[model samples]
Target: LSDRLSRRVGMIVPGLAGMAVMAAVLGAAGWLPDGAALVTLVAAWVLLAIPDGLHRSSASALVVEQSPAPSERGRFMGALGACGALASVLAPVTYGFTAQAAGIGCTFLLSAVSLVLALGCVSRVREASSPATPE
Candidate 1:
């Protein structure tokens, strides 16, 4: 479902999901009442998961689409997998220190900022590679 959605909308799904994550993260930053905090946390978690799932599926499909040849596709996918593995390993340690030093709220804010930056980079890459359309 998400794969088809991604194909139709390109980066918009992930981009919007990233924005939702930012909003939810900000909401989870304790502006709400105690009762609402739990709800906000849950909502934020769900929003974060949406982007994660969408990104993984879309990125995998993009890898397959962009690979030059069948022979190189395996290597491309393997490299992508390696990058994901490295991120999984490093993210926890990085987040722990960041949260410890900057507080959890700041950590969430930083994560949102990173998401925005990533979205911008993806947009630029897509624009550069996309074919020009006739007026």
Candidate 2:
């Protein structure tokens, strides 16, 4: 089947949006009645898996597809790994502090904000990578 949607526009957008939505829902769940919160949490988690899986499935393919040259792919992958490492170390501590000061709900809101920032960064990368049209 001819794909109508490019990975840049199609997969990433929905995936990021799903993540943001999940975060927001989770945040709001904190204010819900306990039973309702549990149900919301379950539903949010279940819904998030779809786009998250889609995003993850495309992630390695995206890396390879976007790499300008074979030599640069390693560099790109290394940079990706470095980012994951940094986030792994920083997110828990930063989130813990935010939660301690604000509330658990705030931490999820912060996660949503982080996802929005990630989307912005991805947009910038797409702009940088796209081939320019001649005037």
Candidate 3:
């Protein structure tokens, strides 16, 4: 409901929504013919740019949220950072392979599906942790 949560939702949505658009563009531009390596290289670069901005916002959220709870804040932030690191290592390789084998449409579709599922999950988490009275 707030801009903060909206931004997080945007983070996941755009990656799926935008990546689908991008995959279509790459297909139209005939970049797919240029081979998986070249297409993946360029796609990776572009997607990386938008999502990193999203990640930065999430990082800011973590800092802001943790400020009052000085105790355990470091552990909380550290675990969050570590989870991101794990995703970084895994996502590219998985996406690259998916794109290479199934074509860009499937790749985009996969991302979209992932985003939808994540949105649902995050919404639930937010609902659970949120105060009974909305702030």
**Candidate 3 segments exceeding 4 Å error:** 1-69, 127-135
Error of 1 at 41 (Å): 0.4
Candidate 1 contains a number of clashing pairs equal to 0
Question: What lDDT tens digits, residue by residue, belong to model 2 across residues 1-135?
Answer: 002345556677678778988999999999999999999999998988987776664554566556777667778777777888999999999999999999999999999998888777666545224422222
What are the clashing pairs of model 2? none
Q: Model-by-model lDDT, in order?
A: 0.64, 0.75, 0.55
The TM-score measured for candidate 2 stands at: 0.83
All candidates: TM-score: 0.74, 0.83, 0.51
**Number of the top-ranking candidate, with TM-score as the measure:** 2
- Span of 10 residues, lowest total lDDT, candidate 2: 126-135
Please give the distance, in angstroms, between residue 8's alpha carbon in candidate 3 and its true position after superposition. 6.9
On residues 1-135, what C-alpha lDDT tens digit does candidate 1 reach at each position?
Answer: 534444315644465457657554664656668778777777777666666766666666666656776678789999989988998999789878987887676667666776677666555543215322222
Q: How many backbone clashes does every candidate have? A: 0, 0, 0
Give me the overall lDDT of model 3.
0.55
lDDT for residue 114 in candidate 2, whole number 0-100: 88
Where's the lowest-lDDT run of ten residues in candidate 1?
126-135
Candidate 2 segments whose C-alpha is farther than 4 A from its true place:
1-4, 127-135
Predictions: Cα RMSD each? 5.6, 5.0, 6.5
